[model samples]
Target: MNLSILYRGPLSSCNYACPYCPFAKRRETPAELAYDRRCLERFVSWVATRTGDSIGVLFTPWGEALIRKWYQSALVTLSSLPHVRKAAIQTNLSCQLDWVDACDKAKLALWCTFHPGETSRERFLAQCRVLLQRGVRFSVGVVGLKEHLAEIEALRRELPAEVYLWVNAYKRQREYYTPEMIADLTRIDPLFPLNNTFHASRGHSCRAGASVIAVDGEGTIRRCHFIPTPIGNIYDPNFADSLYERPCTNDTCGCHIGYVHLDRLKLYDTFGDGVLERIPYGFGESKPFLENLSHAHLSTE
Candidate 1:
């Protein structure tokens, strides 16, 4: 399959401050969110012309896209690209429920992450109903944990047949799954599969060095979210020419970004057993990244 895009940004507000969430303690900054918009536009436009109609785009942000005013416009911009034949967003089903009509206007495929404690089954179902009415495609994901397994199963049954419901392993909080919980998850959607590998059982190496690239809230390309290594700048005039040649410099990676980078190295050591050490020779340079660039490497699809 061609590289699919997984685009994310920091959220403006978080209803539930999950301890494991990276942005859990982060407060929303409208100014930073707005800057993210400009950086996103520049990155997308550059990708369109450089890659040119060969990839699918997945729209996602750290918090929730609907919480920011620029998200709707960002969706509009992404849909305008011909290379962006497919578009999806990972959300918490909070604000989008209120603006289902606006989401439909953006021609996006919605990927809703349901938090049972913070979101109610009735409210989630209401949003699903609205999405179906708008003719927008969507799916539901429940964080896999002993606490939410039952609720996840109920949501799966409650979702429309056309909408797929899957379970996401709760990585930040490592909790054992009871046999009952496993049985419950298996019964919810027998064919249910996780789309994100970050929380999945680790084994695969990632090809992010050559294929995956990300631009941060600024416009610079970095290695991955887990590592703070800078590679190139999407906003730079020469970005298109240098996008694929950037190098990886991370020593330890738990997220999918690390997996992709390691995968590209053809280092298929199993989880907790791979070449988890950084290059002793360094990243080869210590030049300053552009002041306007702050984004990390956008992982390869």
Candidate 2:
């Protein structure tokens, strides 16, 4: 079976202090960092044993992970595994880039996010250029805050046309984005409209527990991060038996990581093998895919 795992460890610390995030500027104690390291090592070891299944891993840490040496080492190690199809992470791109050269570029990808005020656009773009030079597959994105619209548009203009730039809508407040603002952002990212909607997902068929799972540092597994009920632990011998098609229990899912798995959305067709990295299939190709956006059936509760 081809299994996709979103692993989040206990390392909740970041270098930047973005106003919108709770974890902003939070630092972990030495003991806490050591605990996170141990958990990650155990998870990586567990992944190495899953030779019977084709595995893809995305490190969806609460804080920035790439800044830590352990995460970088883990990516390099995981990418080299023959059974691992892809090893990627959601990162702020604030770390050094030389380590990427040690990884198997074909199996390694990155989901890079740009914070407008936290990091200058030029610095982030330079990092992206290094990744491009290294032949790494990645997608760049920004949180769709109204204040950052100008920076977002400028980023789209400066980035290579082949690179896919995505936008995550700010949904903290109701009606956060005006229709005209949405339209402007949508023009830059055709997929922005989908991200802006709070998808009504309760009782909807989703691929979460079956083929895709959210795993924590302790190996506890759930349908996804938004759901708290644990189906099983990854360390359990019978864990594979617990995985099966399950409907979402939440009223709505706004996060891309959670909503993209809704079978009705058919996002797998939109993303193809790049689902974990958040890159659309046929991205950077002709604009024909934009015409089929309605087929995703985006809706809210």
Candidate 3:
């Protein structure tokens, strides 16, 4: 069976200082960094041994991971593995683009986030252009802060139409956006309303433990990131026996990575093979899937 692993290591430091993010500008000591590196190497080595199963990995670190050299090497290593279907990561696009040249473009994808104040728009766009020129599969997104609405709109316009630009709803405050504001963002990103709502996920069927899972630095595996209960460990020999369909135990799942896997949402049909990388099927084409949004049956409470 094909398995999708959302791997988050112990690396929790970032160079950008986004006000809303807890990990912003956080610094890790040399010892901590070394430990994180070892954890990541162990995870990658474990992935390499899973030749009998098709594996797809997405590194969802607390801080920006692409900025580190080890992450770059890991992606390069994972992308070349014949058993690895895809190797992607959540990055801030702060790292140099040269490393991607060594990766197998077919299996290497990136989920890039654009922070307005952290970097200049021109610089970010330039990096995107490089990715485009390199034929790298990627998706760009930004937090839907009211203050950054103008920047978000400008980014959508400036980016290539083929490149999907997504907006992540800023839900830190209650009713943070007005109806008009939602409409404006919706026009830019047809999927905005979906991200804007908090999904009630308790007792809901999800594919987390069965086909997808979240793995921490120590190889502890959980159904998903929102749930802390350990279902198994990736290093355990009989770990495959523990995977099965399970209901979400959390009252709410607001994060895209968590809620997208809810069976009731039918997002798997929406994203198809691109779910791990956050790319919608036929995104740049005619986008025939957009016509089926009404049928997704997502419950937003």
Candidate 4:
């Protein structure tokens, strides 16, 4: 069974300056701004019609999602859907507490990340408390590094037990994991061990075109949000089927959204083994990487 229905959209502007994040420079345009609500409504309606097991829908944004003007309408629309049991948001936790309260009201689990340069540890913990009191199931996402260990530990203690805490490995822009980084994270947070078990293993074997779906601001169904890749328009008649058949050819597919989707699909080996072998030497475009991986697969056969 898959932890399916990852409804990720890049529909916000961030205030952080994280050097390692791929979407660090993301910003929404005027045209893109108005499309999120419509796309989200259509997407949720489509998801509700699907008869399936419990699915988790993640509203992961490139920037601080709470700051987006259309965030509330999108949240209300997605949360109100009948089929979605678990709806979550991945945010920087830099927004005001009211947004946390809104998330709580909508029964959306909050996944907040702690960035030293963006927000202080104290403030992050305070927001955690707000989420807890509001009856929201939440987690603190710690960037896996020695320097952030103390703060993560402190937050673990200060926050409630139900507020699940996890440690995430540091991902530099457009780069996959090194064995060294994995080793380091294993050493740091043993209880919350985070291996690049999702995308690092799966690589280009993404079934995003087949089953997973992401909608951009213009109501277009994209393969994944990391690149400006679109497979079909959600407004089309065969949108779901169209997205379910998209493919990826990325060099290293350990991106957060891609990896999360991989993990949801329980395709860790597809991410890990594929990533290590498929990533080509040339720097530009994913086609060459796909070609190389195809050759490697043919040779194995």
Candidate 5:
């Protein structure tokens, strides 16, 4: 069976001092660098061993990963493989874009978040233009703070229509978004309503263990990012044992990567095979997503 791996190890170091994030404005040490390399090597080798199945990898780092040279090498190497359908990462768009030209355009993607104070909009848009010229798939996003309202609108205007722009709801102040505020953001991010809040998923069926998984630098496999308890190790001989149906221990699910896998949300069908590279959102002249919601509602009744 094909699988999606959310690799999130080698985390907690970042180049920008975003006030909201804990892992900000730090650099990796020599020891940290070595550890990251070794873990990636093991992961690459593990992928080589999985000849029977195709895999998609998303490097969900807490820090800025594109700044690291080894990550560039790994992404290049992974994208070249035939069995790897997708090898993408979440980045702050602070790194150079010339290196991205070497990776497989069809399989490589980026989930980029725009930090207002850390980098100017000009620099950010320049990198995005490079991706577009290279035919690389990516989605741009920002934390939906009221202060960023103008910047968000400007971003939508500058970016091409094919490139999807997303809005990340500020978790701390979600309750503060009045009907008017949500209406405003929804104009910027078509799927803002779904993304602006958490979904109650205590007993819903999900694709977490069956195919989607969150892996750490140490190869520890959790059902998904939200749950940190170890289900198994990827290197174990019988690591497949870890895959099973399990209920979410938490009541609410946020975060795009985590929230997308909730089966009850019907995102699995909405995104189809493009969930790793694209977000399913369209506010104007696009109502299929909303239509899907209604279809999903009738199916259960």
Candidate 6:
């Protein structure tokens, strides 16, 4: 079955200690690093076997993932696959950009998060320049925090107008963003309102479980990160059959990746094919990959 999978590796080590995040910078033990490498390789091998089936994969690691050499190699490997319409990852953009030269930039995209104090703004912007020069499709984003308002606004000014800049709602500081603040952020990221709050998802028809899902390093697949019940195993032959429509069990779904599948949200109207890759889908652009996936979804229905 054609699927969109978010794979979060077991790597818990990060290089940044942002106050907003729990899993801060920590050193990974030699043994732990080895184990993580094995798990990631297993996932890569499994994905290779699914070459005939359409699959869009996003690596959502608990910690910074791009720092690992294997992860870099994996991104290049996945992008080269014909069936992999989208192979993207969430990163802090702290790593070197030279590795991207090996990737199929057409299928590769980055959901980059810019932390104000954690990284040097100049260095981050320089890396962004590399992506633009290489013609890589990517999106720039920052956490929506009151303290970071000025930095975000300044970033928006320096960033290219055509590039999509997203604002992620900070979970711990939900009350920090007032309506006026949202308006300011919205000016930089037109899609800011969508991320400002969680939507009621209970009993609503969502394509989450049936079309998109989360896969842990162990290959265990879940409907979403918030929902931990293992619906199937990614490596298992029966994995494809595990996909089916199910109502959200939670009251409100906040995660962009999860809520985007909610049919009622009509996120498709805004995101279009870009939802899968975390890039803006311009109305005038040709979404051939998404066009193919639409036909696939219709056939399955």
Q: Clashing pairs in model 5?
A: none
**Candidate with best lDDT:** 2
Q: C-alpha displacement of 286 in model 5, angstroms? A: 5.2
Clashes of 5: 0
Question: RMSD (Cα, Å) of candidate 2?
Answer: 1.2
Which tens-of-lDDT digit does each residue in 99-215 have in candidate 2? 999999998999999999999999999999999999999999999988889999999999999899999998889988888998999899989989988888999999999999999
Model 3 gets an lDDT of 0.91
**What's the count of clashing pairs in each model shown?**
17, 0, 0, 13, 0, 0
In the range 75-156, model 6's lDDT, one tens digit per residue, is: 9999998888888999999998888999998899898889999987787888889899998888888998888889999888
Whole-model lDDT values for every prediction: 0.53, 0.92, 0.91, 0.54, 0.81, 0.82
lDDT per residue as tens, model 3, 82-177: 999999999999999999999999999999999999999999999999999999999999999999999999999999987878899988799999
What are the per-residue Cα lDDT tens digits for candidate 4 across 172-220?
A: 4334445665554544333222234323333445656555566654457
Query: Which has the higher lDDT value, candidate number 1 or candidate number 6?
Result: 6
Off by over 4 Å in 4: 1-12, 19-56, 99-107, 173-184, 187-207, 226-229, 243-248, 263-301
- Give the runs in model 6 whose Cα sits over 4 Å from its true position: 283-301
lDDT of 2 at 149: 92
Candidate with the larger lDDT of 1 and 4: 4
Candidate 5 deviant stretches above 4 angstroms: 281-301
Clashing pairs in 3: none
> Candidate order by lDDT, highest to lowest?
2, 3, 6, 5, 4, 1
Per-prediction TM-score, please? 0.67, 0.97, 0.97, 0.65, 0.93, 0.92
Give the local distance difference test score of model 6.
0.82
